[model samples]
Target: MSIREKIVKEYEFLKPEMIKTIGELITFPSVLDEEAVETPFGKNIDLCLDKALEKCKELGFKVFKDSKGYYGYAEIGTGEEMIAVLGHLDVVPAGDIAKWESDPFKMEQRDGKLYGRGTQDDKGPTVIALYAIKSIMNIGLKLNKRVRVIFGTDEENLWRCINRYMELEEKPSMGFTPDSKFPMIYAEKGLLQFNAIGKGESVVLSGGGAYNAVPDKFQYKSKDLKSLEEKLIANGTKYEIDGDTITVFGKSVHAAVGEEGINAIKMLMLALKETGVATPSLDFISDYVGNDPYAEKIFGVLEDEASGKLKFNLGKVEINSEKSLLGIDIRIPVTISKEEIVTKIKNIIKQYGFEYEERDFLRSLYVPLDHTLIKTLRKVYEEETEFDSTPLSSGGATYARSMENCVAFGAVFPDGKKTEHQPNENLAIRDMDRAFIIYAKAIYELAK
Candidate 1:
């Protein structure tokens, strides 16, 4: 059989083992922990990283782990040029365990889908890519360049894992990360996270899943719970009314694509304004920001052919007797400068007597469509899938932006449902099989 055919046959034979490996990785609650010193992120994350590297070693690949337990990589082949397959092992915390149909940490197969926290996001994709490399090796294909599978542990948080990895290792010649959509991505928008803080009255508000996910539930405390309930009923929102508190429910999705999910914090803020308990922070958000997913009021009609329009997500909100803080996440267009976006945001919030502080910023990534790496990956995708799709752009930030000559090539297909950062996140078994074939072919082509 041809090498390609051999790769496919091996992948089919090893599919069950691949599924089992991913399921095993999901059992660890590898969420970030600030108190842990030796592991930094947490013990579970450290354990997950160790297990991944151990698998690499078992497969006869050279594995390396940093002393700090931030990042690790497994490599094969021997050449000056290296192709990196970047993926993360860390997952976001499972918010509201009752929301899941099965245990988020325990992978359950039903209707040909694997239900778990890290199934679709990174862990599953990471394992599948590793197995692809193993399949290539099984075929005894000698590559012209080395292939490195880099595992990161802090992608769901601040990306310190990647940051530390870059500091210690040399940049790859060219590479693609399998953590995004298929047909490949050529550009990703800039990311900006900031807090708009201002003093408020007796109102106290707190809710959200994470900085990267839209808040699905929000709780508000005040003397006007009855009025808030009435407004919520009129608006047709899902909510719970206690004696002096109201809990509002909204759909959660990745902050990168905020338009896909409802922002519960936004709903609560609007309700507060309607009930006459509007603070300056609430007034600023309600009037200036409103419920629009795009920041049209702040920056009118921001868009470009590449990376689409600028998206916004009010991911979090915290209100107390001292000050009210609104955590805002913005995906700016690649062509826009940080100064332009930050200046406009600061100018608006400063007028409301609120202090603006930027927590993090990831610059935009744009590589020309005609580049060699983009063309090679796109050709491989079309050849494997028989779909003539063009390279795309995204608002989601990936490790692709952390290094030069890199883009996010997917484990996610174009027609697949997006469950990243959503409740009951899952990946289909059929999709995993297809992605492995594509990744194996791409890696062989790149390495050759």
Candidate 2:
């Protein structure tokens, strides 16, 4: 059998072990937590890293975990050039426990799909990549270059872990991350997260916990609950009215694709405005933003051929007697400058008497489709899946943008289910099986 066939057989042989490893890793609930001495991100994250590195050692890869718990890596082979497969272990908070059919922390398989938090967003892909390394080793493939699987714990929030990893380690010759779509991601849009703060006393509003997810639940204090209820009912929004508080419920999705989720914060603001409890910030957002996925009202139609249009999400909103704050997430097209977007946003918010503060920003990444790394990955994807292996751009940010000569290869296929940052997040067993074959082949080709 050819080396590729041998690698596939090894992956099939290790399928059970791979599933078990993913299950074990998913049970850690490795969401970012209060920092401790040894566990900088949180105890759970540190524990997850320990477990991952332990598996790496068992697979005969030299393991290294940063003392600060920022990142970890496992490597095999002997060569001067190193290729990296980057992925993250941390997951976003499992919002609304009631929404999940099973425990988000407990991995459960039903009807050929593994369900849990981090199953698709990252943890599953990370494990699959490690096993790909194992498959190559199992086949006794002598690679001319070293292959390193770098595990990060902060891709869901800030990329601090990967940032620290770059500072401490040498840059890879070239790399890909199994954190996005299958054919390949050649371009990723720029990310800008900011907070718009203003003074408001008419209502107390607060919603959303993460900067990258659409706010699924929003609650505000209002004396006109009946009027708000009427408006909400008229608007056909899901909501609950409690004594003096109103809670609106909507779907949650990754901010990069925020159009898929109904913005509960926007709905709540509209209800408040209709009920005559208008705060300036609420009125401004309700009138200007109004649940549009693109910030077209404020920024105009910003688009580029490389990464498509600008995507926007009002991920968070807070209003109290003392002050009001609007947390915004924007994925800019690759062609636009950050200053151009930031200046326009600041000027618009200033019109409403709100102060705009940038919380975080990630510049766009674009590697030509004809690049050697892109060509190699695309070939692997086409040969493995027989799908149209066209390169694509993404609104979601990944570790691929964290370093030079890197792009996001996929654990998700072209027609695969997309559950990232959504309730009942899951990964299909069949999809993972295909990804293992693709990753194993890609690694061998890249490393060799």
Candidate 1 least-lDDT 10 residues: 200-209
Q: Report lDDT per candidate.
A: 0.87, 0.88
Instruction: For residues 353-389, write the lDDT of model 1, one tens digit per residue.
Output: 8888889889898888888898888888887886765
- Each prediction's number of clashing residue pairs: 0, 0
Off-target runs (Cα >4 Å) in candidate 2 are: 26-29, 35-37, 91-121, 196-301, 311-327, 344-355, 415-427
TM-score for candidate 2 = 0.73
Which structure among the candidates has the greatest lDDT? 2
Q: What is the lDDT of candidate 1?
A: 0.87
The sequence of per-residue lDDT tens digits that candidate 2 reaches over residues 98-180 is 99999999999999999999999899998998998898898888899999999999888778899999898988999999998
Query: In order, what is each prediction's RMSD in angstroms?
Result: 5.3, 5.4
Superposed model 1: Cα runs more than 4 Å off? 12-20, 23-29, 33-35, 92-119, 196-301, 312-327, 347-355, 414-427
